[model samples]
Target: MNTPHIAASRRTGFFSRSGVRRLAVALAAVPVALLAAGCSSAKSSSDQSATDVINKLGAVPIPSAPQTQLTPSADESHPQLVAVGSAVAVTLPSGTGTITALGPTEDLPTPLPATMPTQVAGTITLRVATKTGTVKVTTTDLSSRDDHGNDIALTPVGVAQAAATAGGTADFVVRGTFSSGAAQITLREDGHVVAVWDFNIELD
Candidate 1:
């Protein structure tokens, strides 16, 4: 005759084993808890009194602060442009040759303090880094979030001119009627994208 032994695992459900688990866990946790609680040295009588008076007070850190490192600057150097009012223009020189646009270049998530009325703006700037042949150019906007109150215009001011100092030019304009708060401006090219710049606007 053989006898079988059934060992019970208290790791079952709460109703079935929670009490045993609770007891075991409490016993195991006491030592660790005491060790953690004892990590700090006892405060002096003066320090204890000072803390006791402000025990009810709670403090938290301010949100959205910039952190820094002890080394070099982390910003990248690149060509950029900024426009104001209804229309502002910047001209970049490109010699007579073929200019191809590079991959999409953009500014990151700019903090918009306000929206709609503030009319936030941004654009990307590109140069004829390396010329290939006679490259045609154009401007296109695909945000599709147009506000009648805010009128932003994208215009190709120049074409592929075969001159000693010839390149293409473009302009972006933000109208006043914009919600008066914050908005985004995205500028694109015919096939490949050129650049993206961001502007934080506020009511003057």
Candidate 2:
């Protein structure tokens, strides 16, 4: 009779339903896979950026505990020594600010701008923060000096200006040679000298 055909149709319907269910389950997994891939890619990119920054700075952040916050002297004749990875409290024109020498860097993407034949000795990676909502730190506001009181020119890289919000911070890099034994880095705010960070350079 036609009973066999009806049974065959029922079997086909059951198989079709099962196949649809399997297809739905596979489709559901796709989004999860894509999300996982995106997260992995983001993490990898972050790690690469960190590595690049470290390489640009010749040395990594000091492993030791951070030192006390340094209060920079207005007197340039005797600037205080600033330890690596230590924070510096500065008085900006608008209000107060902070600068931290994160570490030394040397693998600059471009050569250190120098008139004489000079090699990139090292770089100071700085993190600057200003509570003043409108205040910013620019490369032109900073300068360096050697132990004997000669100017050691600086070439800034990365962020051109550190424009921070009231609670946020920005980072910048300045590479220079220590041929004359770099001694201090001075920061000025609106043509007024505000801070000086001292460094003890040991060449290798």
lDDT top scorer = 2
Q: Residues 1-204, candidate 1, lDDT per residue (tens digit)?
A: 567655333343333455455556655554444445445576356655444443445222122212231211111132222321112122223222322222122222356235423433333233322232232233443232233434455333344221222334322222222333444454333322233333434444
- RMSD for each of the candidates: 19.0, 24.3
Which digits, one per residue and each the tens of the lDDT, describe model 2 over residues 1-204?
Answer: 556454323223324665455445555554444456556755477555554554565333222222343355332233345656666666555555667776466544355344533344677777867765544667898888877887878777776667666777878787777753457777776666666677755443
TM-scores, all candidates, are: 0.24, 0.50
- Model 2: how far residue 41 lies from native, Å: 59
* Minimal lDDT window, size 10, model 2: 58-67
The TM-score between candidate 1 and the true structure equals 0.24
